[model samples]
Target: MPGGDISDLDKNRVLAQWLEWQLRQVRNRIRELEVQELKDKRRAEQARAGQRWKIQPQRSNVAALLHRGDCSLYSSEMGFLDREEAIIALAEPDIEACQICKPETGLVQT
Candidate 1:
């Protein structure tokens, strides 16, 4: 109880405990970051996928409808249809879905 001697076994145990605590903290931080990263990745993927089917208005020089296409490559004469409104937009006069992507097929059957 009085002096300057700590046993080697005691020192080893203390060291092991400290190391374990540090490892736990590091693992927890990594897990938290990984979960956040996964969420961010999913959000980004959803945005990109939505962009794929975004319907752009296709029109003739006389302002009549031709067909809808993706926003990825659209003409200045065309208009953009919001993703939420795509089904309705596709139903508009002469605005058929693109022959390639077929956005209309994805709409609900009803």
Candidate 2:
């Protein structure tokens, strides 16, 4: 009754528009959070990778190559090797250290 009479339909339309705007904002926030979550997950994975090592199987006549877990030259879905395990792998005559990442640099020779 104050500030002129407004139709019920107009009020409903305005309410619907406000609800839609709120929904969009919520969805945008969800998307941003999802992106942040993905980044955190990737960073965690990289950190884990850095602490481990991996072996790329020999291809053709080439010997198996040892690499730092974070090395991108070879991607292995297989389990990683621990520090001692990496040293052991390096000891193998058939296993060669990666020239790029130089996985042997992290190990101490006994």
Candidate whose TM-score is highest: 2
What is residue 104's positional error in candidate 2, in angstroms?
A: 2.3
The per-candidate count of clashes, in order, stands at 0, 0
Most accurate candidate by lDDT: 2
Worst 10 residues of 1 by lDDT: 62-71
Extract clashing residue pairs from model 2: none
Error of 2 at 99 (Å): 0.9
What is candidate 2's lDDT per residue for 11-107, written digit by digit as tens?
A: 9999999999999999999999999999999999999988889999989999999999999999986879999999999999999999999998848
Model 2, poorest ten-residue lDDT window?
Answer: 101-110
What's the residue-level lDDT of 96 in candidate 2?
96
lDDT of 1 by residue, 32-96 (tens): 99999999997886565545444444456432232333334444333445555776766677565
| Candidate lDDT values, in order | 0.60, 0.92
